[model samples]
Target: MSQGRTTEGVRDQRAELAEANHVLVDQGILDGFGHVSVRSAEDPDTFLLARNLAPGLVQPEDVQVFTLQGETDDPRKPYLERYIHSEIYRARPDVRAVVHSHSPAVIPFGVSTVPLRPILHMAGFLAPRVPVFEARDTLGSGSDLLVGTAASGAALAEVLGDAAVVLMRGHGFTSVATSIPEVVYRAVYTGVNARVQAEALRLGECTYLSDEEAAATVATNTPQIGRAWQYWRDRTA
Candidate 1:
């Protein structure tokens, strides 16, 4: 349904998006409660997300197009947090894909002052300190911590700013990147980084990558993302 792109091209992207959902589930980045999305191939004002269903259950046919306002014409139910992806696309032109997950290792960091930083080279994308979005700060007290509304979603997007990942207090985290594979890599490594960093902290003070080192490693890792993607994609099959 995208403009300019050939039918085959659109089909290929949809297939890849479906594969990505499986890959994330295999990577343990998403279980039953999380979701992933990609910007439309031809329209920035709209994006692609699956109807409300578990990631492992999503097929290419299940993916539906939704406007930046999180509106879709399909009759199938959509994720309540679709606004999270919609508002982020509204905010970040560079981000072609987004992943929202409740990965276990990452939950503790979001509720604590302990920042999630790059603990290893592969997590270089997480350097410069990941930001946390507090729903209560913007939504007021007695509020459920979901980014379920457009205004709340917009607030979360603002907190995400230019960072690759943003943790939500008592919720989970959101990761953004230029493509599906790259975003998956970031989301997977983020939990990895969190686990390692937490373990290192128990051993005493931990060393983290400097900004310059993280920047260099990110540049080096970007080109090699396809390698990880291939491995994860194969595991899903």
Candidate 2:
């Protein structure tokens, strides 16, 4: 691509993601513990994320900068869970953005031993498997529930494969894509699927689309991307 993420673009993305954070909170996708980050539009080696604060309370100035490699520790301003964003962006080149949230319904499936497959029309894109990471919610004591380290990040990137999303077992979800709207859209659909899967699981066995059907559904659902972006944009208005 053009790498056209100018200072203006990054600023705009920061504002948009900031606005998205509030909307996400309004929609119950996030509270104070969750986060959203985007690769810096002006600097490829860095990313922009809000410091650990209530998503809905964030302002444009609340966004801070961080090195992509995660080596430096600037104490002035920092995100409590920067690794989730830094690691994902550093590891997954295809992922331009990532959203980490402890969404209610989705959190159940995260702790579920079984994979959270898509059982609804919206989730057909994630049928069969959604790259569920089988790690425990807590490692030992107080360690953060993330891939841990660049090596682990690379492992997660590999395990995530070419899929657009991944769920940490016993933790939460990381919906990733090339745009903020795409990531947000995936996060929304994921929660919806969690609700559907819960209901379907209640009624004994539930029918799900075959692998081929899932692939076809993704191809056919391309246009919904714009619609989803528009709908969410209007939601907070």
RMSD to true structure for each model, in Å? 1.6, 3.2
Per-model TM-score, in order, reads 0.97, 0.85
The Cα local distance difference test for each model comes to 0.92, 0.73
Q: For every model in order, what is the number of clashing pairs?
A: 0, 1
- Which predicted model would earn the best lDDT? 1
Candidate 1 — number of clashing residue pairs? 0
Q: Which residues of candidate 2, in runs, are more than 4 Å off?
A: 1-5, 71-76, 136-155
C-alpha lDDT of candidate 1 relative to the true structure: 0.92
Which segments of model 1 are wrong by more than 4 Å?
1-5
lDDT of 2: 0.73
lDDT of 2 at 26: 69
